[model samples]
Target chain A: MRIAVVGAGPAGVYSAQELVDAGLSVDVFDKVPAPYGLVRYGVAPDHPKTKRIALALGRTLGNPAVRFFGNVAYGLDLDLRDLLACYHAVVFAVGADDDRLLDVAGEHLWGVGSAAQLVSWYNAHPHADDSFAHTVLAAREVAVVGAGNVALDVARMLVGGPHRLAASDVPERVLDLLARSRVTDVRVIARRGPAQAKFTVPELTELGKLDDVDVVVDPADLAGADDEADSRRARANVELLRGWAERPTGRAARRVHLSFRLRPVAVVGETAVAGLRLDRLGVPSTVPAQAVVRAIGYRGAPLPGVPFDEETGTVRNLGGRVVDATGTVLPRLYVAGWIKRGPSGVIGTNKADAAETVRALLADADGFPAPLKVGPATVPALLRGRGVRFVTWPGWLRLDAYEVALGRSGGRPRVSVDDLATMLAVTRAGDL
Target chain B: MTFVVTSRCVGTKETSCMSVCPVDCIHDIGEQVVIDPVECVDCGACVDVCPVDAIVHEGEADDPSVVADAYRRFGLEAP
Candidate 1:
């Protein structure tokens, strides 16, 4: 069977690998120029080991039965109907792309940004610009709202020195800016108590290992959280946090202040973010912060012709079968990853998610339409005729070589191409 | 015009009587903001943000006993 997997993240990549292993022809497409969507651009550049997954994904794409088509967006270049007509089956694994916002006053003001935007900017996502980091680096104090692993990742990135960040694949421009950063105080504030924080134990432990960064937690913030599981985990994390808080402050470094039971009411200041007005629990007290970044969560976008739940921010699916607006199952269409389930769970979680969807596809394989054979060259020309900028396998290889060359100059494994034009130009040159 | 908050809603706290109010009479107590069921506009913003997911909207005769009990805890009179 000829299968089309939309998205080149872990979910899409793994699904394609599985299909190819089962002796099926697979074509994978992604909106980004590079594959490994979140791994390449959302994960902190310092976590080089975690990035090994991308290399594994690269190997999968190398399989003869598998083809990589980068810079292709559904609903734009190729709509759902067209995909359904071309391939025997279509699997959508497009992950959530937008960050959840706090519907409060002054949230859209200058200097206040989302954690995803900041992460994208540093990781060099094509859409991200230097404006976010420039605004954040200029501030002395910053507040990161949320208590999840991503929140901790953001907090650590802000306080981590350039030396620790040097060995990783952080973009050269971002590293230069961070090396000169004046940011000193980074407060990770959560509306819930410490025991209810969403950070895993290992992530919390990693924060304690930062030499230059101090972890601060108010004793009272742990109150009223005795019974909840999240609270219990938070208490354990706080024990480690307390140990780090007691350590002597290192010279010329930033500090991470873990604040709990604080709900941000408004972003303060006239022109830029001066401070955040927050409401503290169990007391009529409020704390002020200089910069604020909301990291509540991520939300999925609505793919044209797919049923989406606006409230939950997920594509509506029933048992891995893509559902229509009327809640009817659409044959030969499936979904996996964050789009299938709402934006939650870790990277490895997508493995199980993809496996389940693959099972459903195999069970219903006979019902799918027969695959249409269009010559490889004809496919690209057809897409081009539709005004689609489809990056061929050769183009991706060129971009890969360019990133590796760029990384060598910076003493890293790979440097990210942060714009579509640069990626297209390098690919067209056939420099790979 | 009572508004009930269920567990499925994200970020809800357990304080229920804060906004059953019809006349905008609820007052803030620390982080657990309470509503005055008497002057309430019957809007459910308070029930929505509750982290514990404990707000239940009820009609006038659904259960006055439970409503009265909640009102007493918040130091408010039931309508």
Candidate 2:
């Protein structure tokens, strides 16, 4: 049985590994040269321990029955019809890559960027450029909009400073840029009170350990005596935030200001970001800040030939079966992870999502159409014909080696290949 | 316009506004209730579940736009 998993993120890699363990040939494709999508690029570099997932995912890539087709874009390189013709099943584990735009005026101005772009630039996502990141580093203060783990990660990165980032896999360009940043104040503003914050306990706890970072929370911002599950969780998080806030100020430490009940009205700056205009709830008042990074959440793109609900930003499906735009089931197609469900939950949530998709695939395995007979040699020519610049397994291996060598010079584990030319050149030079 | 609750209130069993609504946008806020705006989409599922008879429809009482605006201010998109 042959399956094509479109994406090399946790969902795709895990699903492919599960299918291979169940005795099937799986081809994993990713647009980026590297595997382990968000884990490598979206995650903050200071959290090297959280990045061990990449090493575990590397084992899945090494599977003999599994093939990694890197730098192969889905809609651009090979369309949905092409995958349907070739594989027994096609699973879309593509994540929600698009950032939710802040609808307020002045959001498009300079110094305003999504948490996705910031995380990508620092972690060296190939598509994230240096110019955008430099604009953010130039700011003296930043206000992160939203209360999720990503917001915490961004705030922590801004406050963690150069020493904390040096040993990690952050790009040298990003490090040098951050080293010069005078970012002293990081205010994490949330529209809701503490109880409504989406950050888990462990993530909230990690902020307390940062040496030069002070956590701040106004007592008035705390939720009232509500004992509901959400409120209780918020209370705990607030208690943690308050505990750190009460501590003596650290010498030369940056501040992580946790503000609540504040909705961003607009980003306030003419050329570059100067501040954000925010509406405070209850009393109905407004506030302003120097810079704003909206981290409300991520939303998935409408996949070509897939049933996507625009409101929910998810492909309409039932138990992992792919449905059409009109809700009709598509044969041999499945979906898992964030694309299937709107962006929510953590890494472990993908396991259940993938398991359901796998069950559907296995249940209908006998009905799979015969795959097109294309070997290793035919793939390159076919991709070239389609104008697809797919990085072969060997190409990815070369890029991996090049990154390791680059990292070695800086006394780190790996550096990232941030563009197509450098990655291709490394492969062509037989660097692997 | 005063916002009215529609038919999609299938899963919501508890209404917390009966005691809390200052203008009594809800007639009783306690019992089977209705938003009494002249434009009310009088699908009062909230009426059956309201712990108090505090919900009021448009013609049923005075204007509730001020109270409705409070809900909107909290970032809850008005019904």
Candidate 3:
């Protein structure tokens, strides 16, 4: 069977691997010129180990039974009807791309931003805005509004010291801009208490290990917090926080202040972010921060034809099967990863999640009529007809080599090309 | 003795170790995955499966600091 998987990240690529193992021909499509959606973009550049997963994912795309169609957006390039007509089954593994808005005052201010944007900027996502570097450098004191891993990542990047990131895959321009940043004080704010924080223990602990940076936690925030009913992970987080609360504040130039039980009400500023107004202990409290970065969570983008849940920010589904508003299953339509489950869990979580979706699709395969056998030339013809300049797997390999070569000259791992024009040029050059 | 997931597993939470664990000792703790010593059978199934080669025998860890960090992260006592 010929199957089409949307979003060539961990979900889509892993799903393709599973299907290829099951003897199905798979075509993975992504809007970006490269693969590994969050791994290459959302994941912090310092985490080279996590980025290595891209190598495994790249190998999967290299499989003869699997093909990659990069720089081709599903809805924009080829609508749902076009995909349905071309393949027997389609799985939407498109992850949550946008950040959840705080829906408060002054969110649109010049200095206020989202962790997703910052992650994109540092990781060199092709579509990231240039203003991200300017915003990051302009703020001396920044307030990161959230408690998840993403929040910790932003906090760490702000204070991780440029020398520490010099060895990573961070682009040369980003490195230069960050080296000039005046940011010193980073406040990671969470609405919940210590026991209810979303940050894992390892991430929280890493904040304390940063060079010339002090992790400051309030002793009162850890007082009387009952972790009795919490999971082992939650209990461990509280333990880590308690340790941070007791540590003496040293003479570090930078500080990562972890604040809990504080609800951010608004990003208060006249022109740019001058401060963050938060509700601390049921009272009005204003934290002096030049920038506000909301890292609450990520929201999934709605597909053109797929049924989406605005309330939950997920594609309506039952065990990977896409269901309409009234709970009607749309045959041959499925979803996996962040879009199906509402953007939680780590990258490994996508493996089992995609497996489940593919399982359901395999089970339902016998019920439908045998799909018409179409050659590989059909989809490429359609893309070419629509003037969609798509990148093949070999093209991606060439672009990857170009990026690595760029970084190699600088003694870094890789220097990401973060613009479509440059990426297209690089990929096209690979076709030579 | 139990296996430990070092700094290499921080961002790459590959569960090849978890799937191979007979006792199901590997636990996802958000930032990284850890193997529970009490539950681990010392099968060494994870060492080979680690894509980044993050898994190592507790005694053979190249970096003592990374091993200690793993133990502290999982709330486990060092060997």
Candidate 3 segments exceeding 4 Å error? A226-229, A370-373, A429-432, B1-79
Worst 10 residues of 3 chain A by lDDT: A224-233
Residue-level error in angstroms, candidate 3, position A330: 0.4
**Total clashing residue pairs per candidate?**
25, 29, 0
Query: Per-residue CA lDDT of candidate 1, range A377-419, in tens?
Result: 5446657777666776677888889988998997877787787
Best candidate (score: TM-score): 3
Number of the top DockQ candidate:
3
Cα distance off (Å), candidate 2, residue A374: 5.4
Q: What TM-score does each of the candidates earn?
A: 0.79, 0.79, 0.86
**Which residue segments of model 2 deviate by more than 4 Å?**
A223-235, A248-253, A282-288, A372-378, A429-432, B1-79
Greater lDDT among 1 and 3 belongs to: 3
Lowest lDDT 10-residue stretch of candidate 1 chain A:
A223-232
DockQ of each: 0.01, 0.01, 0.07
Q: Give the range where candidate 2 chain A is weakest over 10 consecutive residues by summed lDDT.
A: A225-234
Task: Write one digit per residue (lDDT tens) for candidate 3, span A1-432.
Answer: 899999998888878888998899999999999988987888777777557668768888999998889999888998898888888999999999878998998898888888888888898888888696588677899999998989999888888877988779888888888888899899999998888887765567678789999889999988767544266557767888778788888689999999988988888888988998989777999999888888999999889999999999999999999999999999999998999998887676688788899999999988755556477888888888888889998889889999999889998877888879889888882231
Candidates' lDDT values, in order? 0.74, 0.73, 0.83
Determine which window of 10 residues in candidate 3 chain B has minimal summed lDDT: B39-48
